[model samples]
Target chain A: MKNLFLIGLCIATASASSMLAQDFSAGSTAKSWNLYPEKKAFFKAKVVDPLCTLTGSCPDNCSSGKRQLALLRLSDNVMVLPLKNSQAAFTGAANELQPFCGKDVEVDGLLIEDPELFARNLYQLQKIRIIGDTKWTKANRWTKDWRAANPDAKGKGAWFRRDPRVKAAIAKDGYTGLGLETDEAFIKEWFE
Target chain B: MFKTSILSCATAALAAFAGPLFASENGERITITGEAIDTWCYYSGVMGGPDAVVGAAHHTCALWCSAGGIPVGLLADDGTVYMVLKIEDDDHSNGGDTQMTIASHVITADGMLYKRDGINYLVVSKIIADLGITNLNHEDYGPVPSFAIPAPKP
Candidate 1:
């Protein structure tokens, strides 16, 4: 009787853990999913600085400061991510982010239904969850001219190409790894 | 285990079908609801009319690492499934254009929704083009409701 009772307790504890645990199965209809490439292919990218202008970098209260925004493009796709949680200023920053476009990466993210705030801070939560990560190779070729894309912007755009060493650094630091997390278990399963 | 980071939180954004929405005679935002079968979740919705779509198109459905182009099952607030689609381009673009890429907020068959982040949101288009007020697409448009906005103008 004692042994049976111990086994029952173990079974119950295991079931409860599974219930709370997030699953990353390939076909599971869970809340999150990652980038599982249909066919394994090497995805290349250009390592450009995430550009943002700091308002009053060395001045008054933090509320009086502002950070523009960041925008990038992967091939023909245009991407706009706000530097801070401010929807009203998203468009203006998006307009400036045009020049800092980067390449498309194969990763996964959790999307939210609405934007929310936590702990009373400017860094608010978005409807989408930032999940998964992918390896990004260096771009050996980039010929697009930003001067033509943004005639009014003053400075020249990011260097179309970068030194080989910088590419390696970005691959190592810029992105989180694609595996070892439950959110990305799908990626490993994709290969199997 | 997928350790959700303390800083890396989840949130919801807007994503509606890539089309025009206009006001009905009753003057309310045309609420669209449906089921997204064969998706992570099932229940779906679309609020806001033409103007909302104009703003949320393509730009609204940008995923962190999504490769674009996914099936969609549109719906309204009342739980009505619209259509089963393989492509949902939230970005502003033509339907049949091959160069365009699309994505959809997938849904399941039993009425469960694939919650993006931790919230559910709707994407609304502009009235003039959505309701075909001025015959933008040439399709026989229907009478859409409009509570979100008063008389559709501009």
Candidate 2:
């Protein structure tokens, strides 16, 4: 009987650990943001494309990497727009939540609210976990995906400075993006 | 450059003062006129200086960034950048029809303003006016990033 009790205790412990396990670590911004303390919330939600939900402009897949995605909270049936991620700087959480489109996931984040007139609530997704799964995914995929896509653009002070697209555009349109004549005039007036 | 420096200093001061005032339980209501800008390129300065990245010159790029899930910001006439949380009934800040429609257009927005971490967040309840691509900088800066307009297929 003692052995049976020990076995049950072991199962309970394992289950609790599994239930609490989070796969991803939160970034500094997750805790440092002003709203983190008062607005943070963890709940179950389904990832969905906002365009399709708002208007019937449904696409084949949410993983298209272009459209914005939102979370439909299971508890209140309210759709939350995740404008930012856990990463520093201004980045969105679309790519982070894209893979889980249409699937229910556990989201750990903040629902920023302004209680005055005409104020709308916005979300900052810090961590996400697929429903029924033990691991949580951090909402920090923008930089990683950007780095992977621009493998050749290395040694960047800022990703923009080294980006091939930006370079090519500048080359084609001059530094000011104006025609050559305007650029020459501006340079002569400012520098010369 | 001198103007930009002064604006930057002024913006910093305003933000420092405004942050606490707006952070109250109830957000402050205000009406502001500004251009709907692409927050990514505007903040990153990837394409060009602040002056070059607005109006018709940067309209195409603004659309691209907004479509790619970068939240749209309203660059007020006073040089303040208000990160738009939501516009009217549209829930998402980026890639929404409303955002796409107003990309680079100068609009008078009536909304509730919330400031957090020195960043201003505006929830636009109504667009008082859309002054349609008023900044005509394209004449001086052609497409800010020429690549924003796709090259025609051969």
Candidate 3:
């Protein structure tokens, strides 16, 4: 019974690890080739790109969101898997790599040498450890749970504090930049 | 039920993710005020930034390969591969030399700015091929010379 519980715990932990957004370890390389992990090597490199062309029908690609982005091939079968939590930054991702003429890079990933791509057009990735000295801490978000923390200053102070940029617009246009700070108005224009 | 402002919202977003490292410690938009011929650096040697960059289309989808290797079934031709780019207006400073948007892609290979639709959709995707922003001129983000170019179809 205890062993079963331990197995369950392990599966849950592994699932959570995949769910969590992690940065790759830096100043590392594919030092050795073992089909499995010997130990977690701290891995880090300036995040580059994958090896796929995105095709879409609309201006913003397909509205459907994806977790597994693309494949990256280094040598014949060398590749890496990089993932993101949100879909916003990828608009920049497409343009950053336009100049390489389809070749001119050295990728740093858990080097899986010559792994054949699967039917899903992906390599079967082996587990590798990533080392990140500076882990990104989650940013604070304003939420109902948050307002519960600070009720008093939630009214006028919160409104003004959020919109310091409003002062710039007001100065330029001779009118108050009101409604809300951030995308309160803009989101509606694009979305709602 | 809720109010969301795109400017202020994106402002916080810039501060949250893009802060302290990219523009300034404050995450403010830093327009370089000068040109560096910069675009986003695609780590992969092929297919430009679209295939390699995580989070461009879908953060997770772009990251699918971050764990390592999904075959991007792209075979290029023997032409100079070009990445899509957007231009920024010069009014902003301390700026990133990212790809200029079509509206702001004034300096073409022929040195003509694109102004169409009253809302410019003008930067050419294959500037290195089209405009010749090659390494001779590009100090920062130049074009790659050799690549996995496929044979042009007969």
All candidates: CA RMSD (Å): 23.6, 17.3, 25.2
lDDT of every predicted structure (CA atoms): 0.22, 0.65, 0.24
DockQ of candidate 2 against the true complex: 0.05
- Go through the candidates in order and give the clash count of each: 66, 1, 72
lDDT of 1 by residue, A1-192 (tens): 654455455555544543331322333222222212111111112212221111112222211212122222233222222221112111112222223233223322222122111101011111221123433222111112223433444444232112222223224322111112521242233223
Per-prediction interface RMSD?
A: 23.0, 19.0, 24.6
DockQ for all models, in order? 0.01, 0.05, 0.02
Tens digits of per-residue lDDT for model 2 on B2-110?
A: 5654555555445544433343534689999999887655654446667888877786576555644577889987777887767886655545557766778789999
Q: How does model 1 score by TM-score?
A: 0.21
What candidate 1 gets wrong by more than 4 Å, as runs, is A23-108, A111-192, B1-70, B73-151
Flag the better candidate by TM-score, 2 or 3: 2
Q: Which candidate should be chosen as best, given DockQ against the real structure?
A: 2
Candidate 2 structure quality by residue, lDDT tens digits, A22-128: 32224322453554112556778899875555344466777376566778767545566677677754467788888888999988776554432112335678888
Which residue pairs come into collision in candidate 2?
A23-A136
- Model 2, residue A116: distance off in Å is 5.6
- Candidate 2: which stretches are off by over 4 Å? A1-30, A35-38, A115-118, A165-192, B1-34, B38-68, B73-154
RMSD of 1: 23.6
Model 2 chain A: weakest 10-residue lDDT segment is A20-29
